[model samples]
Target: MTSTPGNSTEKRQFHGDLIQLRGDRAAKAIWRRVPLASAGSENSIDEVALQEMLFRHADILALGEIDPAYRNSVPVCMELGTRAGAADALYLTPTGRIVLAEFKLWRNPEARREVVGQILDYARVLGSWSYDDLDREVRNRTQRSPCDIVSEAHSEVEEHIFIDNVARRLKRGEFLLLIIGDGIREGVRDIVAYVQEHSGLRFNLALIEAAVFRRGDGEDLIIQPRVLARTELVPRTVLVRKTILEETDDDPLEEHEPSPIEDENERFWRAVLEDFAFDDPEPEVPQPSRYGSVWVKVDGSGFGGWGLSFGAFLNRSQSGMGIYFTWRTGFPEEERVFDEIVGALSSNEELGSRLEGWKRWSAPSGPPRLGFSRNVEFVDGTTIRDFDEAVGWMREKFNRLVSVLHPECWRRLRAKG
Candidate 1:
């Protein structure tokens, strides 16, 4: 191998050569030492270069191969959030899990210890955010939606479902946290153990070591990456929210093939979609989704901070129809507008009395989907005739949502469009 001006003390060599041994045997072949490359300077493998290489050849990481269920995903974003230190990369796993990663070059002993705490801090901060919050932050940092970028590369992914899955994982902090570094130093394993022992976080942490080498010019660089620490042996921590894996058979949201009953429900919603009309311009029609939600959207209204929407949700526990406000977080006066509409819905006596059964609330965190819902059962035993009766009730709810309940907001929203 060609040599560069690097410190000889930092190099690790692998040697081999093919030679004919005349004295030992008649015609014996032997291989001598073959020098590969040197480790080079103290900051030879910097974090930026390390991160770039990993991002370029992420397949080399082979995350899915390590666990089959974790397939069909790629790194969706990098350098999320506005802080001194932030997560290096974010990945979307097969089942919509968030794979949080941190790349470090542990040249400084003090930095190595601090990095462990730093990653945990990142995990905690991320865990507190909703999927909408994450998507918003990712877009602000990278100027593109996480799902949009990933979906462009992987067409099979259903953007809405994929996003929902990611949101769910974030809520539970149940994604894989991979800490990758070169020269992680000794006693770091104990620190990982100490954190795991005391924390209630529900994430998988893996310490990966990357050995970078250069043969001849830097163009022919090689990096060998391996897992040095893993959390598989660590006992699972119970989180306040039930993980999708832990839900019992009785779960209404459990993934399964669409039953005959579900087919009927789909047909019913399709008929409703045909009959329902609104003032918004060429509104996006409601589509069938795996999660038993029928969604409708006004196109241009989303240009501002929020959009106007309608939805029909079906499940065992509660089935409902809602008039929605898709308020994204981090927009101008987002919280004020959201709280204003919610207050209007509650205080308007005409709307309140007529829609006594309908409850208004926003999604817990992130870009909240503010909604006013009316529950109805279309699956259990309700016939088409019964559904017809429910239509009148739904029509009244829709009419009131438009005519009452802060009608000026809708007018202003349309004006913005």
Candidate 2:
């Protein structure tokens, strides 16, 4: 019969349900619920459904009684196992129970005894072969083995073949026996208990009560498995919280020393001055007879003290200029003094107007300030070709200014000369 999606009888069986049994209790309860008649009466239910239930859950069944023919045909009912072995082969009896059939051997005068012994032997062999081995065997039969199946270290191919070859000898040791008709047959229960104890196996026996419900011209066997008791308990819940905060702050302010380049440059200039003093020869004492007065104009802006003497010698014979000294102040204090002189000149407007352009020198980050002074008429700004003239002018001024400010400096200069 054609069936709609999700409309199968199996799907309709359990829907919108919550099983509250915990762990093993759930497994045991489900086992007990299998209808006794359904388990015992092989022809009463659908074999496919029975196989599906057993294979899906790997459940063991207990049979109270079963049709001899169905029982003989299906000894151990397993859906996955039968399907794996023979995909197209139907291994179910007219009754719902799965039929397990295999060829066997017997060589004894006592036919029944030998058959029973052979059946036991077959059962032992089938039991020994694991599910993995059975799957491989099925794959081989279907010519669908991807690669040659390798045997496990402890596996024996002979055992698998032996199990398959025996038919009637095969028996379901602790398999559920379905007892059809009135009540369970006493012999069936004895066989079940015997198999359970002697076969060294375990099974869950499902006792189903079946009654024929007759209504007018219709009669049907109603089968129902006893409902196993169960209890439900709620699980505890846990709460968790996580929080993180980040902070950033500026570093505390601190004072830092001046750059190293400035320090090195200062040291270099001091060394140059010291070397110049060492190289120059001592000056001869002046004779009173040849003494002459010469006015040296010093400019203190460009070079230091040395430029003053040089400028004086260059302008010695100049008519009105005589020996003009020009120099620039290098220290802030010295610059202040020069500024005062400039201020004084400014107070006297006559002298202030006579003064030429002055260049104030200052270091980039330091406090020291300096300026050069010179006579505008004698030293023509147009005629002064390069930095040398400016240097000479500043040096001359430095020497004169130093002499005036500290006479001791003048004495030292003369002594060095």
> Which predicted model would earn the best lDDT?
1
Compared with the true structure, model 2 gives a TM-score of: 0.20
Local distance difference test, candidate 1:
0.58
Using Cα atoms with residue i matched to residue i, what is each candidate's TM-score against the true structure?
A: 0.50, 0.20
Off by over 4 Å in 1: 1-43, 82-84, 233-417
Measured with C-alpha atoms, the lDDT of residue 375 in candidate 1 is: 57
Each prediction's Cα lDDT score?
A: 0.58, 0.29
lDDT of 1 by residue, 1-417 (tens): 654555333342232344547786787654332222224534254567678778666676767644555565577777877344668887776457777788876654576787888888887776666655676788987788787777777765545456557755665656677787765544677777787786655676777766665543334555666766666523334444665233322223312344344455556666555566644334444554333455554434444423444545543323545555555545544445556666765788765665456555544234455446655665443233367766566555554554443344555555545
Tens digit of lDDT per residue, candidate 2, span 211-288? 222222333332322212111111111123553222111111121221232232223223323323211123211111
- In candidate 1, where is summed lDDT lowest over 10 consecutive residues? 247-256
